[model samples]
Target: MAGRLYLVPAWLSEDAPVESVLPTTVLERIRTLNDFVVEDAKSARRFLTACGHPGPMRDVAMKELNEHTAARDVPDLLEAVRAGRDVGLLSEAGVPAVADPGSLLVAAAHAEGIAVVPLSGPSSIVLALMASGLEGQRFRFLGYLPADASERTKAILELEKRSARERETQVFIETPYRNDALFASLLESCRPGTRIAIAVDLTGPEESVRMQAVEAWRRKPATIGKRPATFLLLA
Candidate 1:
């Protein structure tokens, strides 16, 4: 039988899931997951060390498969599958491949008749929406706003219009540094009553989910884009 492809989920806390493995039944699962495919091998190793189990650096294999990863490297992931390696792909934070890397590996795995399993836990997008105070029943996740300020503003206005017309929550993320500009654009584009949610450092000690009417946020002085964040706009 082909080896298992375990997609493990790390916690939002600095202490990774490996620490949770000691609490009881989680230990069994930890033993089963001996191999890993992480987006940031260095970070994973650091987290594991922080968990009080400093393992070898190579314990988690990473072939630079990221947003900037070349399409050619997609095949290495397949080669690993044929070797019957049970690799666990993880994102730097939150869920893997949800606006993170791992899709190439997944697609490659599928093409090679290997299994792809998704281990769920904290997803910033879902968490943000749940606390967004928006119409969660119907929502759309727009991965990222354009880098160009002009186009970014256009996307904000268009997303707001979508929420107004369809009553759907439109979600997107921005580079942490660009978050303030994105909020500025949102203030100028979205309707006054349109709802906006900015979830920051989710699941971390500094986690905060702010919900406000677009108009009020303007007066309150926006507080997004300074830290790692996920943005949601609701009609």
Candidate 2:
């Protein structure tokens, strides 16, 4: 019989306790696997250590699959699974394959006739939307916006327009260090009546989720320093 591919979620914050973000059953499932395809081997090691893997760190086999990984090389990462050895796919944070490079591996797994199992865990995107109090039923996740200032501003306006027309919520993220810039662009480009939600450090002690009209935000602006954050908008 072919082995199964488990999609494991990692903690949003290193400080978050494993028991708080992951179910006991998920942890037990993770402990049973020794081979994994990870975004970063070092971070994967740290996460497995936190999960209390029984074997030594050296014994766990991890294959790297990140932005730098070539598409053609993705198939090779599944060699262990093809050989009847179960493997885990882990993201740097949150659930694997959503807004993550691990999606490529998941696609490959499906094409190769492997059973893919998703383990329950925290996801920043979903958590942010749940707290945003926006239109959860009809929403779209727009991955990272353009790094260029003008392009990002234009994209923001377009998304806001779409949200209003379709009554859908628009969710997106930004590079941690450039969060402040994106926040500024939103305030400047979006109409005063439009609502914006900013969720930062989700699942961590410093967690914050705030939603208000653009005008209100301008009056009481926030600084989303260098931390992971999710942005949402509703027109």
Candidate 3:
């Protein structure tokens, strides 16, 4: 039989202890694997080390799959699994596949009849939604917004309109360095009644989750600096 493909999750914060976010069962599952497809080899090595893998670092086989990886090459990452050796798919942080390039490999695994198993772990997106206290029953995750100022403003307005019309929560993320710009655009473009929630440094020591109307936010504008954050909006 072809080997199973395990979707592994990594810690959200580099400084957080492994047991804090990952359960003992997840760590035990990781210890049994020797082959992995990762977004970043360096971070993947660190994550595996934290999990206390049984073998030496050099003995663990790893293949990289990131934004720069070609579409044609994604399928090749599964060659070890095809040969009956279990493989793990890991993201730079959080769970694999969602908002990650590892989705390409997961799709390929499905096409080849490999059994894909998702191990339990912290997901910043889900954690943010849980804390936002918004319309979790009906929501959508829109990945990322446009970087251009004008385009971003237009996108923010469109998201607000869609949220109002559908009564759904809109979720998205921003690059750490550009988080402030995105926050500014939201304050400027969204209607005063629209609700916005900003979740920063989730699962880390500096974690913060705040939600209020656009009008309230403007009254007390906050800076996200360079921390990783998630944005949620409702109207």
Candidate 4:
């Protein structure tokens, strides 16, 4: 029988209690898997330890896969699964394969006809959307914006336009350090009447979620600082 590919979720906040976000069943499933394809092995080990995994870290088989991982090499990460040994795919944080690189491995598993199982847990995107007070019925997650200033501004404007026309919510994230820059871009590029939502440090002690008009946001600017955040807009 072919083994399964368990898409395990990790903690969003390093300091949050494991049980708070991860259910007992998910933890138990995590403990059963000895082979894993992880975005970061060190963090994966730490997460396992925090989950009360009984086995020694050294005994676990880990394969690293991240932005640096080549596409051609992704299939190799599923070797253990092909050999009838269950493998887990873990992200550095949140659920695996949503906006994560683990999607490559998951796609490989599917191509090979392997069973892929997803365990329930915290997903910052989902959590943020639930709290954003935006239109949950029609929303699109754009992941990240372009890196260049002009391109990013263009992307923001285009997304805002889409939000306005479709009455759909546009969701995207930014690097923690660039949170302020993205916030500034949104204010500059969006119309004054556009509804904007900011969800910061989700599941962390500093968690904050707020939604308001672009004009109101400008009147009293939010100190996004260096915190990780998700941005949503509806015009």
By lDDT, the best candidate is: 2
Provide the RMSD of all predictions against the true structure, rounded to 1 decimal. 2.8, 0.7, 0.8, 1.0
Question: lDDT order of candidates, best first?
Answer: 2, 3, 4, 1
* Candidate 1 residue-pair clash tally: 2
Per-residue lDDT over 1-235 for candidate 3, one digit per residue giving the tens place of the 0 to 100 score: 7999999999999888889999899999899999999999999999899889877989999999999999999999999999999999999999999998899999999999999999999999999999999999989999999999999999998989999999999999999999999999999988899999999998899999999999999999999999999999999
Instruction: TM-score each candidate.
Output: 0.87, 0.98, 0.98, 0.97
Candidate 4 residues lying further than 4 Å off, grouped into runs, are: none
**Worst 10-residue lDDT window, candidate 2:** 53-62
Q: Tell me the whole-model lDDT of each prediction, alpha carbons only.
A: 0.73, 0.95, 0.94, 0.92
Candidate 1 lDDT by residue in tens digits, 124-167: 78888898788889999989899998998788888888788998
Error of 1 at 140 (Å): 1.3
C-alpha lDDT of candidate 3 relative to the true structure:
0.94
Off by over 4 Å in 2: none
**Pairs that collide, model 2:** none
Model 3: residues with Cα > 4 Å off, grouped in runs: none
* Candidate 2 lDDT, 1-235, residue by residue in tens: 6789999999999988999999999999999999999999999999999999886989999999999999999989999999899999999999999998888999999999999999999999999999999999999998999999999989998999999999999999999999999999999999999999999999998999999999999998999999999999999
